[model samples]
Target chain A: MSDKKISTAVIKRLPRYYRYLGELLENDIVRISSNELSQRMGVTASQIRQDLNNFGGFGQQGYGYNVNHLYKEIAKILGLENHYSVIIIGSGNLGQALANYTDFEKRGFVVKGLFDVNPRLVGISVRGMDVQDMDQLKDFVVENNIDIAILTVPKTKAPAIANDLCEWGIRGIWNFAPVDLQISNFDVVVENVHLSESLMTLSYRIKDSY
Target chain B: MSDKKISTAVIKRLPRYYRYLGELLENDIVRISSNELSQRMGVTASQIRQDLNNFGGFGQQGYGYNVNHLYKEIAKILGLENHYSVIIIGSGNLGQALANYTDFEKRGFVVKGLFDVNPRLVGISVRGMDVQDMDQLKDFVVENNIDIAILTVPKTKAPAIANDLCEWGIRGIWNFAPVDLQISNFDVVVENVHLSESLMTLSYRIKDSY
Candidate 1:
């Protein structure tokens, strides 16, 4: 890794680049020029060069970028190489879907447990493990050393549940709740996935086309 | 709407503003200063003013903004007032969750149907409607005049299915597949939700913190 600090925008684009490159590797493409990549990604060739340059410029003069090398580099930078114990709170439709998503396990986000306060949901089997009640949350987090929490609870219950997760020493939060979880007090980071916002964006574009 | 083209960054921020304003309305907070809104949203006061100015500035000097008025304006600008008939093109776990999500319907995105290729899933009920087979996709979309298709299919199927959707007159797509659907040939918009990318971002932040 380079000693220079990278902008948040660059960090955000890294995952996208990683995705595109992974596809390229899957197709047996071992090398790609910046221009070729730009066309596929809908990003400018110069922009791609500039972004990769932040991490020591993976391309040679005319040799272009080595696809597998670049993919591995981004994966390492994104910390996908490490294992993280994850728990899904609010075992609703979305929570159950997350638990069933097999790709996360491949990427090292192991779902240790599913949790909910509802009597109907608790004690139900999810991926071979019983959905635990809220009462068992603290012990589960402590014993399993859960690193992240995927919050899919209702907006009304999101904040309080997030507070509990933080207090129990969860390092990161993948919040799917409608509410934004404020985390200024704890040493934790949150990535809020606002699905409704994205839907609105699509609507905006659709309406614009008219 | 302002005659000048708004930047994509400002367009992205509109949904966040809309959400925050909605929360304010729910709390019975009728009025708020740009500074207060900025503090709650974690955006700078000037930035908020600048973003709003693109839509003819909703603020009144010294008196702040009328929360309800601003919220309504943002909603209208985002095209949330219009009804969009939607179809979930995959009866998988993610697809079913999207079908059950009530917020989209509240905002006028009605799920008219869910589609799948699997025989076992085809006749199953979801939200009072039976999951339709892939054979019905064309007729259902055309007959209902579907405006958007929410794709929750696998990546291998995304591009081809998206192509079919475009051919059948889908105005927009909310894709959950990892693959980016290239739709340059048709006049359609897409919003791809990569859950793994988001999870990777959370992992990146956690790794950075250490």
Candidate 2:
């Protein structure tokens, strides 16, 4: 279990399990069988067991998983116990929305800076942080030790900014732009959040049923 | 191929393929083999064939698939030819961000209405539409015929909102709130966009390699 890294699909389900577990914990529930968790989460019990088994055997065969111990294990695997220094790479609506997000800090991610190409927005304050020019990104990343970047730029400008962000030693990018990036020989990881694509999926599903 | 219903996994991947096809079409790529498409998409060649075959046999044995024809077929299957009316619940930061998003229109989905519980925001204008009170949700859904509901409420309130939206006859929900819904006895589908989980995965990947 120590050497077996979790799959991407299982890793994405951790927050969901954590949220449900938080409710159970608040209600003073001490333990939960895999079946109960699966029923509540609308997932198969076997699937839940398989996902949990990726890290280690947390749940007892007959009893269940200890609530607190499982929570700590998930937190450690998700890197939630370690604080992440983040910077937003655009000052548009999406970036501003992210800057105003109160949930990130609580989830162990702190926005240290904001960057924009526009000169007017560069000097303005958004959610208590001054928006800096794109020219300052390299120095800011190096000096501030920024580990995570949120890309909210338009489609055309995303890849260039991504390349520059990688060059500045940024390792992770949460990209909101609807663009597929092409980069090489960098430690950077990009997660594309295409809003249109998600909506399109909804339209597809609804259309099929209706 | 015609008898079997397309899997949800295959349906989800259609948008990804559509995007890639769009790029290929732009570059004047008239035909593409399943192997080529799979390699470009980071999926197995056999998987590409299986997904396509589930919809219809659009590919030739040696000549491969006609890119334009395949794109059209996939688009038709995904209901992209028709426009979808979308309504947003919870006119908070995330909702505001989604309302201002113009990308959906490009992909045949229109943001027709915005709803909120806050009295202050109810009458406010956003993206050419006035934010309506939650009391008007039923009428709006019936009159405008909202095909999808975008849930941007906090985690604690997500389930209730989902239930309300479901009862209102929404066939699809794009849930931004970090919770798995317990929707019952409906054709409604929920896709959870857990922001923290995505970041956590990125962090874990970076940590694993570093």
Q: Which candidate wins on lDDT?
A: 1
Tell me which residue pairs clash in candidate 1: none
> Which 10 successive residues of model 2 chain B have the least lDDT summed?
B200-209
lDDT of 2 by residue, B11-37 (tens): 888888888888789899999999998
Residue B118 CA displacement from its true place in model 1, Å: 1.7
TM-scores for every candidate against the unseen true structure: 0.95, 0.89
Per-candidate RMSD vs. true structure? 1.8, 2.8
Reference-based TM-score, model 2 = 0.89
Q: How would you encode candidate 1's per-residue C-alpha lDDT over B69-106 as one tens digit per residue? A: 88888888789999999999988778888999998898
Residue-level lDDT for A110 in candidate 2: 92
